[model samples]
Target: MGDFSALGEKLKATRNKMGLSLSDMSAKTGVSKTMLSQIERSESMPTIATVWKIANGLKIKLETLLDDSSQLYEVKSIDDKLAIKDDDGRMIIHSIFPFSPISGYEVFYGVFKPGCNYSDDNHTNSTTEQLFVTDGELEMIVGQNTYRITAGCSLSFDSSEKHRYINNGDIDANVLIIVNYE
Candidate 1:
């Protein structure tokens, strides 16, 4: 959200490629022309909902539009403070790489403290989630089925149903997760 220039550039390029003017885009996206102009000029930051609307109107994927980089080669480092937290910060997820159709998947590193329990909603019907426990153990409850995964083990399941993760270990549980949106 902080870097508006990249998003602005992408938005403008996509709109121009589709041969849509600001007014046409506004009507299609249900966003005002003034707001669209501001976004294109990098003077305003679009909220997640607004971005979703634009994606739907453009018939494009959310991550495709949100992705700031489409380079062939790059390196990224994750810091603890940049993690997405849940369950009152007991569980943290760091995005190694966001979803990209070119890559066919997104990568995340997660850490769950002892006694941590995190519940997540279902994803798209075609999505699958793979998790590899790097340290300690955790129980993954995918819909009605539950599985215990220990360190050095991995599990894969359809992610279209509700899922929950619980770390019963006394130590922190670390997992590498890949989400396939194919």
Candidate 2:
């Protein structure tokens, strides 16, 4: 079983340790207070974009949300990985980076096991996300429309548009998600 609830609890604790209230986080990240509350309560999972917003707002790195002991070090390969576990202790490999210089944009390799997913949210600036499927399939729901991308396929869209990704396949799915902050 994954422990996403514990991860959420740690996120809440970190937010409190930084002296940031839910309202403050919502204001800073543009995420709704209601949704933030749900995340804290382990009722829902925060999307990658949501996590990025919270990380930037908290003036902390993304890895901090995964593990409290991770330093401000950089990751530069498939071996360097981060996982977000669900309350049931199901591990989801959240992000991956390769050996390269840090640019304004953030890149990630997302691996979604069967029946896993994250919802979409709003963005401040003109953020863009491009995903290339490596294995299995992905069901992307953007606004009221839904699309599927299979292995060897890719898709890109603006972050301002509401979007979500789910793995409806019985096997695992791998995707490289790249986000451009600018």
Question: Whose lDDT is greatest here?
Answer: 1
Tens-digit lDDT track for model 1 on 1-182?
54555888888887886778999899898988998899989898989899999888766787557776856476666763378988988898998876543456789999999989998885864488999999999999999999999999999988888999999889989999999875
- Estimate the TM-score of every prediction: 0.60, 0.51
For candidate 2, report its TM-score: 0.51
Model 2 Cα displacement at 44 (Å)?
Answer: 52
Residue 73 miss distance in model 1 (angstroms) = 4.2
lDDT of each: 0.84, 0.73
Instruction: Show model 1 residue runs off by greater than 4 Å.
Output: 1-73
Model 2, 1-182: lDDT tens digits are 23354657867887686567999888987888998889888888877788888777766677666654444565466664666655233225455542211244566767777777677585666478888999999999877888899999999887778887788899878888887665
Off by over 4 Å in 2: 1-77, 86-94, 98-102
| Model number with the top TM-score | 1
